[model samples]
Target: MRAVTVLGLEGSANKVGAGLVRDGQVLSNPRFLPGQTARHHRGCVLAVLREALQEAGLEPADVDCVAYTKGPGMGAPLVTVAVVARTLAQLWNKPLLGVNHCVGHIEMGRLITGAQNPTVLYVSGGNTQVIAYSEHRYRIFGETIDIAVGNCLDRFARVLKISNDPSPGYNIEQMAKKGQKLVELPYTVKGMDVSFSGILSHIEEVAHKMLASGECTPEDLCFSLQETLFAMLVEITERAMAHCGSQEALIVGGVGCNMRLQEMMRIMCAERGAKLFATDERFCIDNGAMIAQAGWEMFRTGQVTQLEDSWITQRYRTDEVEVTWRD
Candidate 1:
């Protein structure tokens, strides 16, 4: 069979990205969303598309299929990307493929790390999930019951008045490195599910009380928060690995780029005689290459979405989509 080319668009969160993949290789570097506002997402999408194509040395006519993240994201941004994708597909008379945001993360992680059949830990601003492949689907073994891990951290950063420039989580991670104290915070994990809302609330209260009493510093809070929460994440990921009888764990999504979390996960995996696979920030964070990679796989298997079926959704579940491309 000839190599198929897929142009992937991703605007699930604050990041709007575009990438092109041919066969199993990425043709161009991804373009990430620029601003926090949704007003520029449409323009970002178009700019990213044009840039990706230019970098790939290909035009719209060269793309065999068009794919965009369909759901489980902010509505306005998803709609913006979806509209562009639909328009492009119609204009080029090419096939349209609607990619799930989570699946894109997982598949992209697998591709970059080459971890076959590993349990996946997907953590981001909007999602925190522990997944394993079962039968014909990526089953959710564990997830956040309340706010996502990234959201918890982002909100806590706001409490500390940290800069959201670049990223709040990254700034918190840097601050935690200088921390000397470990403020005791709530660690709530029920079965395989974890809840961060209570922890976040408790930390906010602690931050306020510490500011009044000068007992605990922001560094301390950041340290304790990361240690406690990352422990929960590692614990749940370990459980998922054991339950699925897998020896490898793949970490994907924006938060997966944390060196602290990666080190913690590495220690746990080492103790269990397992391997941990993760990508750098370029691939771990939301990107179009992952979307394009997954889209190429689905497109090869005759999976395509019609114009009417390419609706954007805010609550699409990872387990809802069948893993038709994977055995």
Candidate 2:
């Protein structure tokens, strides 16, 4: 079989990313943020696509297929990337593939880590899920009932007026390193599911009191927040591993890039004799490479989406996608 190149666009969140993949290899991945507002998704998508193509030293016609994140993201951003992808496919006369955003993260994690089959923990600003492959689907073993772990951290950063330049969560992680005290915060984990709304509320209240009294610093709050939320995530991921009877765990998404969280997960996995797999910030965060890799699998399996069927949705569940590439 001849080598096929795919251009993948991702705009599921604030970050707009473009990636080129050929024969299971990523040629280039670039991202852009037009502005802090969500209104710039379209412009950012176009810019990143250009940047990615330039970096890969390829033209639009060179791509054999066009793939994009289809759903389970912000409606506006998803539609923006979807429209661009569909238009590009029509113009280039390339096959179009619609990829599940969550599944993209999992597939990308597996691809980068070379994990055949592992329990997945996908944590991001918009999603938190413990998943495992079962019967041609990425079944959700557990998830957040309220906001995601990343969302909780982002909100906490906002409360402290942290800069959102690179990422609010990144700044919080840095501050957390200097924290010597661990403030008590609400930890809510109901069975396999976790809840962050209560924790967020309690933390915000604590932040206000701390600011007024000048007792606790932002570093302390950041530390406590990371410790509490990451611990909950690790606990749930461990439980999922035990239930699935899988010895390997793969962490994906934005929050998965946190060193503290990864360390905690590593400790938990070590205690249970399970291995943990995680990628760097490039693949773990919202990136187009993951989407391209997943789309390649679908494209190879004859999973193509017509323009009519290529629509954006915010509530597309991960389990709704059929894993045709997996046995």
Candidate 3:
């Protein structure tokens, strides 16, 4: 049998990405995200697609299927990429697969880290969930009740006027290292679920006052925020692992790039004699290669999205997709 090659498109939020994957190997992944708008994605998607194909040194005919992120993201950007994917699928006369964005992150993390059935922590700007696979689906063990942890960090960064060059969360992580004091912040973890909106509100309210009064520096606030939020995430994740009796823990999504978060999680895992699995920014952040990888699994398992059923879903949940590719 020939290797199943897939072309993947991702524009769920700000980033517009294109990538190619053949079987389990990633060929090329190019991304561009200057702004969060359909117009920006529309303008740069084709260029990114061309760049991915060129970098991969493959023609359109080399691909066997077209895959794109179908939901759980910004509406306009998702629709824009879905249109591109649909058009490409029709143009190339190939099958189309619509992948769940969260599943893409989980699948890619598993593929990269070789983590077998690890409990997953999926954290990003728009989502935060503690998940595990069971009964032919990825089940959500815990999740954010309001805004996500990444969003909390980004909003705090904005309050500090931090540069979003790489990402707000990244800048916060860097600043947090120089922090001398850890200011008190609300730690809200209820059962398996966590809440960040109240913490965000509390921090935002005091940040300016603390800075003005020399009570705490921006670095201190960032440190406190990171510690508070990551502790909540780690708490819930550990609970999920204990509940599932899982011995492996995996972290995925954009916020998973934070070394501090990983460090905290590692400590928690080590205490329980469980291994930790994670990826660098290349695979952690939203990228097309992840979508392609998830799509490859689906396509190989005889899953395809008909043209009429290719509509984008902004609120697609993590546990919705059936894990046909996995036993």
> Per-residue alpha-carbon lDDT of model 3 for 1-327, expressed as tens digits?
989999889999989899899989999988987564799999999999999999999999999999999999999999999999999999999999999999999999998999999999999999999999999999999999999889989998898999997789999999999998989888899889999999999988998999999999999998999999999999999999999999999999999999999999999999999999999999998999999999999999999999999999999999999999999
Best by TM-score: 3
Error of 2 at 323 (Å): 0.3
lDDT comparison, 1 vs 3, better candidate: 3
Clash pairs of candidate 3? Answer: none
Candidate 1 lDDT by residue in tens digits, 1-327: 788999999998888889899987889856665666477786677778889999999988899999999989999989989999999999999999999999999988998899999999999999999999988889999999999999999999999899987899999999999889988889899999999999988888768888689897888889999999999999999999988889999999999999999999999999999999999998989989888998988988889999889998899999998888888
Model 2 over residues 190-288: C-alpha lDDT tens digits?
A: 999999999999888779888689788889889999999998888888898889899999999998999999999899989999899998999988999
What's the lDDT for candidate 3?
A: 0.94
lDDT of 1: 0.91
What RMSD value applies to candidate 2?
Answer: 1.3
The candidate 2 region of ten consecutive residues with least summed lDDT is 34-43
Ranking by TM-score: 3, 1, 2
Question: What TM-score should be assigned to candidate 1?
Answer: 0.98
Worst 10 residues of 3 by lDDT: 29-38
